[model samples]
Target chain A: MAEPLLSIEELVVDYGRIRALKGISLSVGQGELVAVIGSNGAGKTTMMKTISGLLKPTSGRVMFDGKPLTGVPAHRVVKLGVAQVPEGRRVFAQQTVRDNLVLGAFLRLRSGQKREVAEDTERMFSIFPRLRERQDQLAGTLSGGEQQMLAIARALLSRPKLLLLDEPSMGLAPVIIDEVFALIERLKAARDTTLLLVEQLAFRALEVADRAYVIEQGSIKLAGSAKELLANPSVQQAYLGAAATH
Target chain B: MQTLQLLISGVAQGMIYALVAFGYNITFATSKTLNFSLGNFLMLGGVVGFILYMTHNWPFFAALAAVVLVGMVGGAVLLKVAVEPSLNQRSAYGWILATLAVGIVLRNAAEVFWSTDDFKFRSPLGDSPWRFFGEPQPDGSMSGGLGVYPQEVLIIFVSLAIVAAVELFKRRTVFGKAVVAVSEDKDTASLMGIDQKFVILFSFMLSTAIATVGGVLVAPITLVSATMGTVLGVKAYSASIIGGLESGFGVVVGGLFLGVSESLTARFVSTGYKDVPGFVVLVLLLLFKPSGLFGRAAIRKV
Candidate 1:
């Protein structure tokens, strides 16, 4: 079998003394959409941050595209084709939407891929037409849903081999959440991106992801194909809000 | 005519303060730290230039270039030795004391090398005043035109040019944008593949370079002394605070306002009270609009 695109082994991360991620391990295959679902403080965000080089793991290793990314700084992680859409969609609020998108392609611009960068920028605008309409507006003024779309589009502008999205459905209206999920579905159907999504919206995430892991208190409690997890009684009881017990 | 002359001189002096305050803004924007030794950098520029040109017989342009290079290096050192370590501790006011210590060290070092006495810095532009429009004197002798020293005019022009150039660079260039991005949100900038530490270091270098240039320009007017930076540095800090610490344009406006007020007081009120208005305005502005005239209050998300 082809090697997994990303591999995390027995990762342990600590914030001072409290272990945020305790002996957690996971992997993503090429062209796969993997969702890790958990409640708040379940180490989902910590895991994503570790993989993207934002946080250092006290023990264990993160191998991305056959590289040990344990001690690499966050800025260098982008060069390895890993883009993270951090929690809360931290767009450059003072900058214009267009500027934010352009900054997403900062590495490309720095490398003098001017023509390609411009083309990709246009592609982003086309993909998110709402963003195109508000291209000149300050990103802070955009609605929450639009900001999330901008964040995702900005990540894609980097043309990453792996997209780490933390809480994409967070703080959105039900209709907006549906729209975001639909966009993710379309992205998955395009089949050119590998995504590791962390979500609190378990049922919705399972519906879209090909495989899912249920993490409780920084450790994986269950892992299975999305269909299996969706049908499993324990997952249904704990996450899906269905009163089912195995 | 007197008022016009005061206005011109005030504006010229104000430009120097603006330059210094602008330096403060550059460093503060990237790292949220201010270099107390900024004024010392300005003094270094003038004293270094004076030593090179007047004492060592170096040409004016060469002396200026050498001073600027020294200022750049001083800025890098200030970042590494003062600002960066303080920031690493994440203590709120640690950098303040650390940078002030650096300034004191620089001032003492200058004293050791150049002596404490103020030395006349010969202007490369010559001491001749440019006359714009002369009026007839009471004794029937023509003495009407407003006369401005060429160095003062140079100060005005260079300050404006630097501000414009920096504004353009910040808005147009990718690297400049990275600096801005780092200033706005360091974590987000890092995630965007920008090295925040490098940007902060570059800002300190730029800040010191600007202060050095200001010193070189003002030296011909104020003369060079090891202690010259003390009052000027305090006033520049005042100018930055009054202008709003975050706003670059605000610093210029604040500097000009403070300069004009000081000049006007010295002329109309009393020369003894010349420095009174800047501090007074600073107090009043702090009481009312702490964000300054052109500064926007920052909004933070939890």
Candidate 2:
């Protein structure tokens, strides 16, 4: 197997005495789409936050590309080729759709690739045509699904090697959820982007992700390939209850 | 003719107030903190310019440039000690006191250097009488029966220029766009490679430089004094509260409105009551529309 793109070892996080993540260890290989599924308060979001540098880990190691990421700030993480689409579609609501996308390429300007950046933005528009239609409109006015698309597109604009998404399909219609999933699949296929996704949607996550980790109460209860875990009786009981067994 | 004179004076005074109000908006928008010492920065601008001209014998243009440059430096220093450190600690109140202390120190230091006596600097616009439709006073004053001074015209011109330039920059430049992003959401903006602390410092410097210009413009009419900026700062804050600090356009409109109204009140009503109306408007605005007239209300998702 190729070298892991990201590795977390013995990561511990606390919210003022309440332990959110307890010594969790996980690793993802290059171009792999890894899904982390757990109920609310199960430490999944906390893990993503720790990796992205939004929240510092109390103890443990986060290594990206063989470098320690313990003290890096969130924005520097993007510079190191990791971008996060934060929970709740925090898409700079007051800005125009085009402005939101422009900010995604903030660090790219230093690389002196303006023309390619413009082309990438055009490609993003083509992928999400609705965004192109509402390019001038304020992001706050976009519909729920469109906002989600904007959020993902904004993250993709950074041209990150690894995309970390937190609850991308939350509160979306079933059809829109499928569309978002399809977009994620397309991104991974075309861009060779590594994905570490946190989702509560069990079956859909397993369908898109090559490997899965089930977390509960700040610890990982199980981990395996999608097909193997889907067949595992305990995994089914923990995530899908009686439906998966059926 | 007298009514035209009052209108000219109102516009000039309004221009000065608008600049100060914009300064308040810049720091408030980016940092969500107030520099109660804003007026002192304005005072420093004029005092510094005057010192450069009268004491150091610098040319008018050079003195003006020196004033602006020094104001920018002062703003950066204020940000480093008063704003940035406080922001790191998440202590908003520390910025308030720290900025006020800096202002106090700067003002007193100026007093020691310049003394308290008022001095006149020749207007670059000269003694030319600009009459809209009136005869010069019998005393040969340029009031031209309208109280319009040549320097006041300069004040109006400079104020409009600064506002127009800032608006264009915010719309067209990459740096300006990044500033808007930081103002909208600091954490997310930082995630996009924006150094928000630096942006905040740059914004405060820009605002202070503009305010210093406003001070230099109006210093001829109102004698430059260390204490001159305190009341002006309060009035400008009132204007910001009136305009809605969230929107730049709103801040300017509110400033002009307050300036003209204050001028009218001072002329017709008691000068003491001139600021009263502004403070009343401020209270009413906070009570009724905390977002200001042009500010958009954000929804709390949680």
Winning candidate number (TM-score): 1
Q: Pick the candidate with the highest DockQ.
A: 1
lDDT tens digits, residue span A1-246, model 1: 489999999999999999998898889999999999989999999999998888999999999999999999999999899999999999888888988988898998999988998998898888889999999998888899999999999899889999999999888888898889898998898878999999998989999999999999989999999999999988888888831110
The residue pairs that clash in candidate 2, if any, are: none
lDDT of each: 0.89, 0.83
Task: Find the 10 residues in a row with the least total lDDT in model 1 chain A.
Answer: A237-246
Proportion of native contacts found in each model?
Answer: 0.52, 0.45
Residue by residue across B1-302, what tens digits does model 2's lDDT show? 66566677877887787888888888787878877778888988888877887668888999999889988988888888777787688665887778888888877887887666676756678645565545656785544344467988888888899988997887666678788888888877877777787888899899889878877887886877777787888778777778888777888888888877777888889888877777777889899998787777863231
Q: Write the per-residue lDDT of candidate 1 for residues B14-66, one digit (tens) a residue.
A: 99899999999999999988888999899888888888988898998898889
For model 1 the local lDDT of residue B110 reads: 91
Worst 10 residues of 1 chain B by lDDT: B293-302
Worst 10 residues of 2 chain B by lDDT: B140-149
